[model samples]
Target: MGFEELEPIFGELNVERAGEGSVPSRRFLYHVHAADPSHLRIIVTDFHSNAWEAVRSIVQLEDMRDNIGIGGSWLEFIDYVLASIKSQDAKLILEGGLDTVSGAANAKLVAQKSKGMPVISISLTELVGSAASAAITNLSLELFKAFKSIHDLYREEKELSNQLTKALAAEKERNENIQSQLEQYSKGKKLQKISSSDKADASALLNNGLENSPEKQTPRDTALTKVANRVVPVYRRARVRGVTLQDTEDIEDE
Candidate 1:
């Protein structure tokens, strides 16, 4: 939705976006909006995940913003998130060789002004309490991992269900196809018997073949073939796919 819909979520978070100058090693809460809900409704790119780790805070965030970010007006929320890092006796201690995080021209200028030491000034863009941001970031990452795992499992189950449904349909079709072929063979046999036999015997045999003998003759009918240019087949497939319909002794008679 729009900013109005986000206001309630922001109210829950009780914080806003922290900048690059947030260097106080304490805790603070903040929120960052992602995108529209309908198109891609995922709540990724949260401030709670990337904030403290991006700036590496050792302390917690709860100790930082006092009555600052939430349930208050917009100006109060901004004031809560935006604060310069005031390091009281927190000067950088260069333990070893000169290690500057930045190699910019302005850093060189500041270093020249501060004697031969490399310039290491805090950037005004960081947030107020880094440790708090980092804690939120850790929690958010765990949630995301859990969400992804659930999503993957759901997809796998759906795929398996679809495959099972397809297999069942194919089996049903194959059974119906074999049944039709068997009926055709039985009808052909009955017609031939009628042409050669007398009235009563012919009728009885035809009725018997249609009823009691239909299922029994399926395998036998499949084994015989019509002429294909006086050869076994124009093209032949193995009987590996055939469904058995006869008793062993009866089939051996063929």
Candidate 2:
């Protein structure tokens, strides 16, 4: 028993990465950060009793860099974690397993921010009390579904935006067409009014000429008939296009 306890104490416990740092190290610390914390490593000058366990507790088992077995049994791991906690006055740090790096980072960040303290690793035995796989599998499935749902909503929003662009363009064209038609109608009404007044003036002048002419005098009824004949074709065309018309009577074609 003395041999085992003194073994780690004499051999230097290598201090591997232990704090939040780069991506690779951070990943190592994620799952284990709360369980362990930190991924960087250093060679501790003293203490070999729990050196392997200390490194194992904090070192990431999962990630780009695979955790090679440091050649220690489960019992050795427990000893190392327990010793480190008692020595440092910290919680026993444990191997949190893989997929806990994010949690570790969060815990590490929070403690350092408020308390200005280093990350403390809890013991491994405290964590893996049971071996239930159901909850882990369910969580993985739910994450996949959530990602798929977000992608679908993004696609729908993009399609709706495209449809709105087309509808707005079509509406603009319709308004322009209506505006042009109104302008044309207004010009036509003004011209028609002026033309009708001119016609009345010309008829009055012709009647006065006929009343005063002493030789070969054209009759008022004959002059009016000529004017009516000329106006008939114009009236017919205007009526075809739905314009208002004035009728001339008591007139014969000359």
Candidate 3:
């Protein structure tokens, strides 16, 4: 890429320093200086091919244009840089443990600081690769696990709701049955009371007839016989309705 075209994308460049720079046993090398206010430095070291072209390939991506070209956050820029390099299949090491450093020449500082921060190191040959793949994979797995856990909880809640509904239905049915039985008991008691009253009236009528009859034994006997025929039939009907003889006698005495 022409220096005029690359300047707008990468900001200022030190051509003299980059051209003269050399890393031991490396044939191709490229270093992209991060724009102001960010401490990120992207260094590509290729032993067999052109590393500068790899940076150019990354610069052409739509993501690079949207993130780096359009003035996005440092985090977004870092992601774009990482993805771009991985697409090139360049073997490199990623270290977030990197502090605010001026140059890529200080490998010692980057290594020492790596121990202090969360770091994932991957590389092919001496050139280290990006840790993006591992980070993305872990995040995706955790999201999936969280989704499954929530789904299970919802299913359990539904089952419990169903059980509670069934229990309530059963309880309602029991209440209705109890109410029906109470009604039947009340009707039976009412019929018993009516039968007892009838038996009492019949006994009272027989007593009145005998008392009103003549004092002579023959007339009193005839009156008693007439009352007995009518009263006995009514008393028998009461008995058929479940009024016991003892119950009828108790009513007559009362």
Q: Candidate 3 lDDT, tens digit per residue, 1-254?
A: 22222221211111122233322433333344333322333443332321221223334434434532435653454454444433322323222222311223322101111233222222211232333333334334544665778899999999999999999999999999999999999999999999999999999999888877676358668778788877547777877899545676788899
Give the per-residue lDDT digits (tens) of candidate 1, residues 27-106.
33222332332211112123432231122121212222232224455444323332211112122211212232221111
**Best model per TM-score:** 3
Arrange candidates, best TM-score first. 3, 2, 1
Looking at model 2, how many pairs of residues clash? 27
What candidate 1 gets wrong by more than 4 Å, as runs, is 1-128, 196-254
TM-score of 3: 0.33
- lDDT for each candidate structure: 0.38, 0.39, 0.44
Q: Local error of candidate 3 at 82, Å?
A: 30
| Alpha-carbon shift of residue 66 in model 1 (angstroms) | 34
| lDDT-based ranking | 3, 2, 1
Models 1 onward score TM values of: 0.28, 0.33, 0.33
